[model samples]
Target: MSQLPKASLKLFPCTIGGEINYSIPEGVKMEILECRNFIVENERTARRFLKALDRNFPLEETQMSLLNKHSREQEIPLMLKALEQGNDVGILSESGCPAVGDPGALVVAMAHKKGYQVKPFTGPSSFLLALMASGLNGQQFAFHGYLPVQENEKIKSLKYLENESKAKNQTQLFMETPYRNIKFLAFILKTLNPSTFLCVASNLSCEDEYVRTMTVQDWRKTELPDIHKKPTVFLLQS
Candidate 1:
């Protein structure tokens, strides 16, 4: 195979939540096989995903540069250096699209700043999937990664998002730490207006995936699921 010229960085998105074999596509698998260098959130997670795509792929041969929360500060320098060497690289997040809610954004921005191309591949995204099934204003929506950990701040932010959704006729989307899902749901039910619409999407792309939209009033009557420790996305629109 002839050496390909210096090309755009590939942003490969893995499934948000599910079995990799069923969720990942052949094209994505090909992309994974093509790249020998990658900037991943976690080397172990990336290796496992690549193995799921192809059991025989040489995991030890691939060069992976970590870009998680702890290593983020040092990643750009290394990633840029690799790109400058005319090597095509892939950015892999633990779940969903790289840089969407992940730490890979900084590297992507640097790639753009250096005038290097950055290409995003097709894949699952919890927020987009949730918005599609949300029955809310997808045309105008926002994704606030995580809510405040404190009770008072969480309530205040919920009220603002609810009001913003109602007044501007836009969808307001957000997420919480898996363990905090139940508590977050409770806060949404308590803070938002009774008429406001709320959508809870959990374990997306998984066998037990759940995405439901309902009014705050109606949600009060419905029993909350055990979303603890499950990847979940929440949306609100009035």
Candidate 2:
């Protein structure tokens, strides 16, 4: 489902990905989708997977699925039912804020469809945090959500952004799946103009958080961090 900006509303999307690798509390049953590793009781592997995904590129979407059909549609009803039954169904993601930049468009779409009033609770966001700390012109930043996925087109897309970030001086922020964070960082180091500055914000809102900044050339000279190992966000400024 498409998410709007966060406010003080209890109704919101959760990046269950954020709670991945942790034990699922008893009596806190959820309709666990068969997307990640089966870890109904604990999801260590799923947690790490998503963490790495966050480290590289901002995920373009967070679609929940079941056999043949999607589950986010069902999720809205389930959450409503949960609230009725004195329980709250957490629309959790593998990591990070749900529906912020991840895949929760269908669920959010369904909630609004059924006339549910939504109020978002404040939580961590990769895009906003990166822009705030990048030391760039943040007043007019434009988050492109996620970069293009196709290989050739993705590079071209980034190149185009190079011009946009330079000409307009808007800080550009995005991410990929956690496992690809390192590779993506490598590409950013290799491609973006030398004078521009890049920031890699990793494991944001976590104990292991790391943010690295460097020019294109300096990035090439120094070894990059293993961002693929955890939640990471990439930011660029001219």
Candidate 3:
């Protein structure tokens, strides 16, 4: 009699800041060969990543389902069908680790509830990378994900986070859309206390990676980096 396959949900992390030349472990490549079903943020980018990992990856045979901010809650369960059939299912985010700040968390949570084993691969996380180099209190840090887009609300949120950091001596981390990087930096400089420390990590792990920590007052005097339309993480501590 043939042995039954052991089903598992694998979470694979990709390179951050859109740099694809970064190295992927041989073990991860070997594991990718075992999974024929993938839940990804973008089918095209996932296919490209797999192809980049291995030029001869079996793209035609593999199946990919979309899972992003717009994906419906009802459609998530369907993505796990392959696991029920005793096949390993993989989750891929557009960049960095899946389910960290991505929509893949929903499926991972469901997998756990349904009693499927979840295997996460080691990879770079932009936020953690920023914190490590930010020269701030790493022991106590919180990731706020993103700040408000509106001017008044955004300023209000910044003040609140700065106050919280001061009260707890904790590091507060946040990010903004690539296109709004410059404007957001300006807001941070203008709103936060001059004595507060701020760190801006941009295009992490890429060839043009930039990570700098400085006081809000110092930041005002120094020339700004060309972070426009580039991925960046901001850290502030008062």
Worst 10 residues of 3 by lDDT: 17-26
Candidate 3, superposed: residue stretches over 4 Å from native: 1-3, 18-23
- Judge candidate 3 at residue 146 and give its lDDT: 88
Give residue 12's lDDT in candidate 2 (0 to 100): 28
lDDT of each: 0.86, 0.56, 0.89
Candidate with better lDDT, 1 vs 3: 3
Model 3, residue 15: C-alpha shift (Å): 1.1
Residues 1-238, candidate 2: write the lDDT tens digits. Answer: 5554332112222233344333232222222321221211113433444344345322233322221123434544543443333332334443334555545545556556755544444444666666666676778777776687788888897888888888997778777877877888887777788888888888765556677778887888887787876767687877
**TM-score for candidate 3:** 0.95
Candidate 3: the clashing residue pairs are none
After aligning candidate 1 to the native by TM-score, how far in Å is the CA of 4 from where it should be? 6.6
The local lDDT score (0 to 100) that residue 19 gets in candidate 3 is 51
List the lowest-lDDT window of 10 residues for candidate 2.
33-42
Output the lDDT of residue 34, model 1: 83
Clash list (residue pairs), candidate 1: none
Candidate 3 structure quality by residue, lDDT tens digits, 67-117: 999998889889999987889999999988899988888999899888999
